[model samples]
Target: MIDIFLVPIALVVVLVMLHAWFGVGILKRGIIFTDLAIAQFAALGSAISLGYFHEEYFYILTLSFALLSAFLIAIASQREIKLEAFIGLLYVLGASGIMMVLSHSAEGMEHFKSLLASDILFTSPNDLYKSAIIYAFIALALWKILPKTKGFVRELLFFSLLALTVTSSVQLAGVLVVFVLLIAPAFVAISLELKKPLLYSFFFGWFFSIVAIIASYYFDLPTGYSIVFLGALLSSTIVLFSSKKNSAQN
Candidate 1:
């Protein structure tokens, strides 16, 4: 038997690491929608692949779609037009396309459920390890590139990191929870005003994730929702406390 709870817990950690690496870049570039956009695109990839291939193929296909979306978003961001509007457009198109594909091809509603909100109980240790490996390589690549690249090349690398992280997060945390994972730690890092933002971001991401995991197991709540809920609570508390501190200082 699989230790179902642990797998999602591990996945939550992987997602936090991913966001720490890429979320900072995406936020700096003013493309916060990148995570949500690619997550929908990932669902589209999985839906389309299910028509011809096994569900496992969704990972690679989703990765490809993520890269493609990132390139397009990068181009849009460089333009005068608002990228959020485009992101909104693409998000609906991707999600609707997936729904249509799944509806026509598959019989039951379970497939849609998986793509919409994943069941963490179904995740095995093997899946957690796989997610870890994927996140590790991508995180390593970003770490390696951040110092070496500069100018336009550096910008491009950040976009790539955003794409990779978004795709991997979609696979692990599904679309909804992934955005929380991307934003929570980044928000806390900013409010805390840490000297090394990236390192602090990673620390908080892991910290909140562990808390979320334990909460989920003990409460028997949905793992993804639990993670996001706890993260949101923590973030809110931090912001509230920070505001009080600022008021006192003033």
Candidate 2:
């Protein structure tokens, strides 16, 4: 039983570490839905692959779409238009594209649900290994290369790396899982004004993820949904109590 969970747990740990860092950047940039949009595009690409080509080179298609979305967003960020609105449009476009692509398929609904919240409990070892490698490379770029860039170049690199991360993560977890992991813990850490926000975010994310995984095993709940539920629950509780504390102080 313990052995069975080792791989999944390891995968979640890696996800928390990398995602928490990216979450900090996203929160700071105030582009909260960026990950969701990118993940949706990635899923749309996968849906296209499955609906038409039967899953051949699905990752390549997904990564390509994600990168394209990233590039568009990067360019748009330099303009004076409402960037959030543009991101929202991209999200809707990707979502509707996925539906249209999968409309005639018998497994459309199942594929849609999997894209939203995958069965991480059954993730293959190969997927986990590939995801780890991708995340590690992104982490290295963020730590070394990102800090040296400025303005448009920095924004482009950031979004490009984020898109790649979302592409891999959506395959391992799901779009909803990726969004929650990218936002909730980071939100909580920022709300509480932690000095080491990224470290705290990692702890919060890891704790909830582990709890959700164990709860899913005992309750037969969907692992991805369970993680999202627990993450939202914890973050909301923190926000509620923190607001109350502030009100009392005032």
Candidate 3:
């Protein structure tokens, strides 16, 4: 049992550390739905592969669609239009397109459900290793390259990296899990005005994710959805109560 859970736990740790960093940046930009939109597009690409190509070009299709959305979002970030709303539209378009693409497949519903949230409890060690390598490169870029960029180039690099992260994460975890992991911890840390929000975000994310993993193991629940549920619930609850307390004092 311990050996079986080792890879999954390591995956959770790597995911939290990488995602919490991006989550802070996303919240600061105020484009909260960016991950969801890009993730939806990634999912659309995966759906296309599953529906038509039998998942042959899964990574290429997923990254291509994710990069396309990131490119558009990067452009929108430079423009004066409603960015969040535009991202929302992109999300819905990708979502509807996925349903349409999968409509005729015999296992469409199963695929759709899995796309929303996969059972990460059984995640393979190979998958964990691949994701960790991908995330390490992304982390390096974020640390070394991203800070030097500016204006449109900066936005493009940021969103492109996000797309890359989401592309890998959505495949390993799922769209919802990716979104929650990318947002919830950062949301809480930012809301509470932590001095070291990134570090706290990592801590908060790991706490909930690891707890969710343990609970799922004992209860036989869906591991991905359990993480999503606990992360969202705990983060939101903490933020809300903290906000109310601050408001009452003021």
Candidate 4:
């Protein structure tokens, strides 16, 4: 009795919200590639699970690995090494390992496809519940840690957020959408001069994603592609309109 179309849309809303929040946090730390790398690592984790573990445990294993990867990224961010380099290293290593793992298994294609992009239509309420629980944990953990954590602790908080970001991104875009989820709304928020960029980005990303979800459902288009396109469009429109308004004020 569930409306399947609404499923993906609602899922996208939750995902975009988490993505925007974590995206902003990552940008604040000046680590553009961090989330993407962590996401790929998470995908690698999922591939391993699908290859070896019971199918029932695939998501749990994926999430755990993603959280662990996030912790690693946070630790790396605290180091003196340039973040992009560290991210590059992580992505390459994770991706290569995933490929190797998949190669050894009969379900390689399924895992590969899931890593490349997941079909949100197939996601069930149980999947949503699991995602919600993990996201809430990450959010609550971040809330507790961000304010209290000094230098390294702050990085840890961001790291937890990054892990959550990877989970959302993998579910929504597989591995590809991670960067878009991380960067687009953050880009929009930066141009707005908002008092609370984080909140603004969350709203904007969520709204934009929901719009795309609806659009895709109505038009029979690809949900992920539609969301990304709309997100980019809205971001561009906002930046352009803001610049024009500023110019007019001057």
Best model number under lDDT: 3
By lDDT, the better pick of 1 and 3 is: 3
Q: On residues 4-118, what C-alpha lDDT tens digit does candidate 2 reach at each position?
A: 6788888999999988888999899888888999999999999999999999989899999999999999998899999899999999999999999999999998999999998
Candidate 4 per-residue lDDT, tens place, 167-242, comes to 6558656776556666788878877778888788877777776777666767877666666677777788878888
Residue range 1-250, candidate 3, lDDT tens digits: 7886788889989999988888999999999999999999999999999999999999999999999999999999999999999999999999999999999999999999999999888999899988989998999999899999999999999999999999999998999999999999999999999999999998999999999998999998999999999999998889888885557667
List the candidate numbers ranked by TM-score, top first.
3, 2, 1, 4
Error in Å for residue 232 of model 3 = 0.9
List TM-score per model, in order.
Answer: 0.82, 0.96, 0.97, 0.80
- For candidate 4, the per-residue lDDT at 211 reads 72
In order, the Cα lDDT scores of the candidates are: 0.72, 0.92, 0.94, 0.74
> Which is superior by TM-score, 2 or 4?
2
Identify the candidate with maximal TM-score.
3
Query: What residue runs in model 1 are displaced by over 4 Å at the alpha carbon?
Result: 1-6, 51-56, 105-108, 240-250
In model 4, residue pairs whose N, Cα or C atoms come closer than 3 Å (at least 3 residues apart or on different chains), thus clashing, are none
Question: Candidate 3 at 235: error in angstroms?
Answer: 0.8
Q: Give candidate 3 misplaced runs (Cα > 4 Å).
A: 245-250
Higher-ranked by TM-score: 3 or 4: 3
User: How much is 47 displaced in model 2, in angstroms?
Assistant: 0.5
Tell me the TM-score of model 2.
Answer: 0.96
For candidate 1, write residues 1-250 as lDDT tens digits.
Answer: 2365556666766677777656676666666677788778877787777865756677788878877776777677767898789988888888788777777665425666666556564577776787678777876887676789876566666666777777766665678777777777787776677788778888887887777666667777776666667777887788778854457667
Better of 1 and 4 by lDDT: 4
